[model samples]
Target: MAQTTAVSSTHRLWIGAQAWALRRLSAFSRAPRTAPHLETGTRGEREALFHLRRLGYTIVAHRWRTPKLRGDVDLVAGHGHTLCIVEVKTRTRRDAVPAELAVDPDKQRILRRLARAYLHRLPPRAREAPVRFDVISIYLESSPTSTPAPSIQLNIELNQGAFGWA
Candidate 1:
């Protein structure tokens, strides 16, 4: 009976430690506040990370940028044998258009260039792997005035192979 109690106490301590680690990780991952729009985008990226993990993706990088590049990739994930370069767009309810539509031709061109730069830095074998571009559009619905701000609803749309190489 004493041995069983000791095991139970050890399990509880392990679970508590896991919870504490998760809390610290979350706090560290949170972006600093800036413009409201940037904050919304940061929140959307967090949401996207959760959504993709739920869908069985292994996220390799977040906000990946090279010293030679001016822009950054929102997320890099692996699905099967494909390397996905993702772009995340977040907008509030006030926006009339779908956020994915924001990745216009000019943006696609820039993303392709960045992708090339990313692949060039990889090992030759890894660089030969298939590549795909994806876009995640997140629409945040404002809560009712009576409801707390933390309860905002998110509508996320994932567009795989959103565009081809330029």
Candidate 2:
């Protein structure tokens, strides 16, 4: 009888441990959805990263911002002999305005200033490399509900040397 009780206690402890582990795993796996704009931006950046990698650009920084600088660069990527400062714009089908239109002349000026700051901080080798401004626009479309997992179709456009230093 004592042996049976000991085995039952051990079994209960094992079950309890399993339940705890499962809870932790679920918490880890399930990331809460962010606000629509934030989610769109994150998804755009991710897609941009993949696209840049495929084109053989090494990513140097993401969302690079400094307290001294007034603006941020979405991505800093390096190709063979050039450095690219990228701005990422994401828009859902519901958005009336196109993504590229958002980067106006004012925004281009800010990006140029930020790029200067970024270059100043880089090592001599990278600083000496030619710099180009790029814009990556991603249009997102929601998938039909019949699919098991929610998905988005992305239409990406990469504009290289979209703007130049002033």
Candidate 3:
């Protein structure tokens, strides 16, 4: 016997979500609000971090804040002697732009600075370890109808000698 779930009587989601999104998009299309937009991104980032940990990375931070720049690195993890500073971007297939495309030059510069800050904050023994910058992009074929996991695609673009100079 297989487990079957009965459809709930009250299940109108898109109608509600569309209205919410429309209201949000309309209200701040001019000045732009940061808080609400981050809600969706945070969920995706957490999911990405989960997947990364499953594949053997030890997570160090989720959203490490800094005074100079206010942004997140999504997931920071370590593997063996290498300290991996990962930038996670998640997107659906419907979007023409891919997730990794989110990390632009400005974003890269900030991430680098944050990585340095993170290193600086670490204890002396940990700070001596090698640091690498990795960009992990997750593309999901996600929709309101799916109970199963998204068709997750990961593209890991790592700058091998990221902090070799320093």
Error of 3 at 165 (Å): 7.3
Residue 30 in candidate 1 has what lDDT?
Answer: 62
Instruction: Estimate the TM-score of every prediction.
Output: 0.78, 0.74, 0.62
TM-score ranking, best first: 1, 2, 3
Q: Give per-residue CA lDDT, model 3, range 83-105, as digits (tens).
A: 87888766555467756667777
lDDT of 2 by residue, 1-166 (tens): 0001123445556555654575457446558867868966876787677666656677889999989868789999886678889999988774667787789999999998888888888888768888888898988887777879666677888888887887
Off by over 4 Å in 3: 1-37, 94-96, 143-166
Residue-wise C-alpha lDDT for candidate 1, range 44-137, written one tens digit per residue = 8887876666565678999999888678999999877788999999888746678899999988888898899999989999998889999999
Q: Would you list the C-alpha lDDT of every candidate in the order shown?
A: 0.80, 0.77, 0.62
The TM-score obtained by model 3 is 0.62
Leading candidate by lDDT: 1
Cα RMSD of all models vs. native, in order, equals 9.7, 16.2, 11.8
